[model samples]
Target chain A: MEENTTTEKIFPPGSVGLVKSQDFHFAPGEVLELDCGRTLRDVTIRFETYGTLNADKSNVILVEHALTGDAHLAGYHTAADKKPGWWEEMVGPGKPFDTNKFFIICSNILGGCSGTTGPGSPDPDTGKPYHMDFPVITISDMVRAQKHLIDHLGIKKLLAVAGGSMGGMLAIQWPISYPDVVESCLAIATSSKISPQSIAFNWIGREAIMSDPTWNNGDYTEQPQKGLSIARMLAHVTYLSDQSMSRKFGRKLQTAEDYSFKFDMDFSVESYLNHQGTRFVERFDANSYLYITRAIDYFDVSDSADGDEHKVFEKVKCPFLVVSFSSDWLFPPYQAKELTRLLLENGNDVTYCDIKSHYGHDAFLLEYETLGKLVDNFLDNIYKEKEGK
Target chain B: MKIAHNPSDSEPILSRSDLVMIADMIPENAKVLDLGCGSGRLLRVLKARKNARIMGVELDQEKLIQCMERGVPVIQADLNEPLSLFADASYDYVILSRTLQAVKRPDLILQEMLRIGGKGIISIMNFGQLDARMQMLKGHMPVTKRLPLKWYDTPNIHPGMLSDFRDMCREKGIKILKELPVSQHRDFLRFLAPVCPNLFASNAIFVISK
Candidate 1:
């Protein structure tokens, strides 16, 4: 087992330690009926599990990852790895998710380009990448695929379905789609429906991707690096706030004392976004990005109820812990509050908080201490209540 | 459906005397919403003793965490802002204990409270109490055990006399369901509170309805 080191701790305390991702291939005859009226076969889900699933399988917490996040939620795949996981701060033996107490499972989302089967994966029938032929998947479709994975584990009900951002949308969808399968939900920095502003940003991102000649309409052998990078750069701006950007970069020039005056990434913020864009294209697929953002834009938890957001949650019985950040303009606190309001009006248990942070939508991943405590207490209480029953 | 006639010996230590009185006033299994619920002490008490389904609305970050720790459902929201998130008549009782005076507008808060809940329980610290009067006479601001913070540093921007609350209720057509005057932190002259609440009581709990 190799150790991942980001800081002084070569082997960090409270770490879940070295873990490996496992792929679950669906058996024949289990066709996934997608929301877009397409049938998907030979589905494969890449997942990682931490801790132990207790007797009766009641201690499981299904962690859904945000856009660009994969099955590597915590721990390290190799000792030479520089980073452990996306949410290593909140998932460890004694951390917020508390592997000592509850079994944690995180899977790469369906429309993802990680180890999971996605647009980048070879189509079973064609023996070639699905590319643009990949049927549009929704957040509910992702949850449905996860449900199959959960059933394959022989778990009847999850202790909680937890996630942030697009992951939060999955968390919100789980209980509504399969109320009996979820005990509770933790939705952080997400809205039940994508706002128009967010949809517009996604539009620009897709435009940037499709406009690239290398994209070849998602059929190129080589990845559309420039278009994907630009898309990632544009998407990254939405994840951060103006206050955060100002505080982090201000008007400081990157590696330059004097202004270039031309279009030469003079500002530190520009350089940072450029770096983010460059790094993203190396890991993510252009087609997967298109599919995932479209899935997010198409997500509306209230779609089944004639656009009545309140009525959509009529079948949901589980409690919710909805959290948003003070500076997150993308999925603002008011949107989370509106979701909470609808849940409350429908007579459901909902706990909410607009955490005071400058981290914007990314606060869900950064504000570990505050966010961790909230998650810890919520999961602890839910576990206790489950045990008592 | 079973109501506790008296508080159990196992009540949480965070519960104050005034909070206990407010908890006692709530019925069994009542859906209660506590506005400015500091650390959720009263909500916990109601949940334990009365089997109430309780939620809290608190603005303070630390208190919001405390509420989560205590397993009480809470929303981090400001009292001065429009509480339009909660629908009308969604709760059995809405509580603003010991926090009415600190709000920007007590009248609007009371109306909101009543709108969301069937009954609103407001505990207001009396600005016209004898101790406050004595302090005013001596030309110093009141700093009693109940109202310990200095005038300059206090959050009590809209502090008012007990009669002021009654007059506002009357003007707004809000009925005073019950009023319980109570002394806080070992005050000696507590017995005279109910007799002459405006002049004697350190603080009073008013159960009002529209």
Candidate 2:
């Protein structure tokens, strides 16, 4: 939509890398009104679309971003932004989400710190960062915002909609909210609702952010940073696997051999966590973190009905392909299966696979090579059949 | 406590309402085979409703997808053509719901149904209603709620009356374990047709066994 040239190397040959952002402008310094009644003026969403949209705009695949992910799904953008695309393993020329045949669209979520409008934006109502005053948002509300973006792109029907984790939740809702729009869906490492333990971890992250003295009730515009760093460290633990952590570090020391048992970073785990947290603050805003995580925390679900028996199970009219990770304790397998069962009972076309991986809840994002093959096959079938339709 | 094993436990293909009714008739934890199960809804319900093990057979690819989605154990195949897959009397209850009229030869299917389950439930719409007669006289086959479609598009290959089916059952030595008919949807056709339902009843939902 715009004449823009950008490039950045994200990963080594085999693994997946950073997510990118590119889009048409609604004019520079434009203001975006959020569904929460909070307006984010002068806002931009980082986005990338692979393959071709075709003549009918039917081969579009909307990829939802994970917690800390941006829209940059592959390649580079600028020198300031270094790192491979987040889904480097799963998406590329010939991966599962094959960018070769389908038009893949990914965006930095609304409340994300990277390029999207979030709490970091100037609050039109108050000129300063909305901080705690940023109204709470639901997953439905998040979908609502994305709907605007989709409409702007002028896509009519989607061939396949897919995502993992928070992204997966969006993929599942896509068909239900916009029934006739999606042909088949790919929902991985997600659930109908977040588990209790996930909520607890989210709260812990929030508390750690609030407890920091630098987080002056979220008023430190220049740097309400330390608190967000701590929150990221805690969240990072949940993202990685026990086996991965053990294999990568073990009980080995980060520095000295002897037990200095002080508050210093003795274990490699501590050093790794600190590094992840410290890097997070540089690209992210504390207020935005507060807003987005809370949005994810507020997810609660039941039957997708609107009081009509004949119309109740009618919402999810599209074919479903749901995948949940076996080792994802946060959302877990039961919740995923529960989603599968409900959709099945409602008479929707569905396929669910619970992938076995010890990479923990964030495995869907990291375990790209495995996820890549599944995506590739799933899309190739759809693409071939989609030709006639 | 005698629960049978089914392949479709991982993929249930029935609706909530269909499952509820199927559950009501089946004994708790009994062996079940749901034929023409659109996504194994009834079988899945029986599984959860009574912890009964169920095997479902369906033809449609979409419904099969739904069955797998629900984790109800199911096999994607036709219900007719001798069910040599399982042994004789491998099931306790064989269910054919709203699928009788759709089959080319329901009589053969019913015979298989009885052979598979010691007891079986057969739910079919009564085509010998006064409404069909009225439409026949008025020169339009019939289009009531029970017979929703106009003749051409109807899925029912051979529509027959309740008495007609019962007559066929009698010929096959299939005794009526229970026979229930409906007019106002689930509310039994009572007061009007009780002692003799041949003329008054408009729809029939029955349970029979060999």
Of the candidates shown, which would achieve the greatest DockQ relative to the real structure? 1
**Stretches of model 2 off by over 4 angstroms after superposition:** A1-20, A23-43, A78-82, A125-127, A303-313, B1-210
Q: What lDDT does candidate 1 reach at residue A177? A: 91
All candidates: CA RMSD (Å): 2.6, 17.0
Clashes of 1: 2
| Candidate 1 residue B33 C-alpha distance from true site, Å | 0.9
TM-score of each model, in listed order: 0.96, 0.62
Cα misplacement distance, residue A248 of candidate 1 (Å):
2.0
The best candidate in terms of TM-score: 1
Model 1 misplaced stretches (Cα beyond 4 Å): A1-10, B1-8, B11-15, B184-188
Q: Over the stretch B1-210, how does candidate 1's per-residue lDDT look in tens digits?
A: 222334465556443667767877888899999999889878887898789999999988889989988889898888998898899999999999888888888889999998999999988888998888898999998988768899999988987998999999999999999988877556658778778988888888999999
lDDT of 1 by residue, A88-183 (tens): 999999899999998999999997988888998999999998999999999999999998999899999888999999999999999999988899
